[model samples]
Target: MKKYLGPILFFAVFEAVAVTLWLTMDHLFYLFNFTYIGGSVALGLVLYIRKWKYARLMVQLAVGLYMLIYLGILSRENMQIEGFWYYLFLGVFEAATIHYVVAKIAGPLLFGRGWCGYACWTAMILDLLPYKTPCGPRRKLGYIRYITFGISLLFVGGLFLLHVPDLEKVMFWSFFIGNALYYGVGIALACAFKDNRAFCKYICPITVFLKPASYFSLSRVKNDTEKCVSCGKCKTVCPMDVDMTDNARRRKNGTECILCLKCVEACPKHSLHI
Candidate 1:
């Protein structure tokens, strides 16, 4: 029961938040757009104090609610079939605003993309999924983010250079289709390749942007090397598959780190203190 509890609780929270947002769309719009300045305030607090865990959870909840409102459910209503290009622009703008600007800039600079671990709708969903891999020898592949970044640039640049009006139509259709494909592919790869977060490391555009920004964050997971036992529990529990033992020994945070604090939580000898 303890083994399954984390994933189950994650799902329960996700569903509760998603359903609540779905039911209270108007209130969310008011809070997110006008009334609530909580996010910015929270960002400042986290940055000033280096409160990684609290900050991460707040941003995560905010972003998760935003995603539920914008992409998961409400998006169906807002999508315009007739003015496809206009709708595409709206969608792109929204994604950039939330993922790149808000999450990447405010969240990462303050709390090191803790939102990736705590708040992202996709990440939250992924966290709930069952894993077959016994946490084992983990490796860091930070280069994969660069590849994803290049592809995102190409996709955006190609559309701009080609002056493709149909690009909007294509992307509009892709909103639903692309999301399904990403999740489907992520699940398949996780099951087959045993990479717990293959999509996050290899394909998420938000991650591509956030990883670089996170380097400057004041709130980061740091390891104490001198405390010493190199048991690899931290590495195995890591969804991103970063070797926390290696990170602790080296006294450096791996770029692939999502700042999930699973490593901090899993450390037995108190050697892998974050």
Candidate 2:
């Protein structure tokens, strides 16, 4: 029971959000949607605790595939940064806007980059590549994320400003084409940089929202300094290159942590945990 407590509390939090949104928005789908996502996350957490190697990957697949296929493709919701801008421009509080708030914005305060680790559809595919850890020098192309973020904003804002015809149809196609490009770029970057999360490190627009909020994340990897032998294995396994051993919110690449626990697994001294 002690081992399962964390996931239970998370489920309770999500359930509260689910019910609140269902009542406040007058939409029962909110209840189902949050429940399903929360359930998948909790299940994955349980699997991880039980020492399942593919636990995080399974959760990523479950949540990412549902959002990509059911929400984006079938329901025609973009669920990307561009979609957030499109809906925001229209002053709509539903769908993409709501998703951006819960997952990419406010939620990062609690879970850090859990979305990047266990939910992002683009990263789901990227994580499958050969390079799980960075094999070479990290590039200084982090500025590209800001450029991509600006491009997403301009793309949607420009369409609205021009009063484009069949806006909904355009957004649907944007969802389709945007995902294709993300997959393509993510894969190429992974191979080029020899790092599974190369695109996430340098080009993900959503990180603009994720980083600041996640800087204060409640559920971050922490180091037990008293127990640490300082062998430096944690840094070697970290896909995001987070210096988890520092145990400080201001540590280098601190906000980039995805709560993946690879550092914890790699720690020979058993000094890291989330």
Candidate with best TM-score? 2
lDDT of 2 by residue, 19-98 (tens): 99999999998999999999999999999999999999999999999999999999889898989998898999997898
- Give the poorly placed runs of model 2, Cα more than 4 Å off: none
| Residue-wise C-alpha lDDT for candidate 1, range 167-264, written one tens digit per residue | 64555565566556667877775665566576676666666667666767656565577875777767667776555566432334455667766777
Q: Can you give the TM-score per candidate against the true fold?
A: 0.62, 0.99
Query: Which clashing pairs does model 1 show?
Result: 60-119
How does model 1 score by TM-score? Answer: 0.62
The 10 consecutive residues of candidate 2 with the worst lDDT sum are 240-249
Q: Return the TM-score for candidate 2, rounded to 2 decimals.
A: 0.99
Q: How much is 116 displaced in model 2, in angstroms?
A: 0.5
Candidate 1 lDDT at 155 equals 64
lDDT per model, in order?
0.55, 0.92
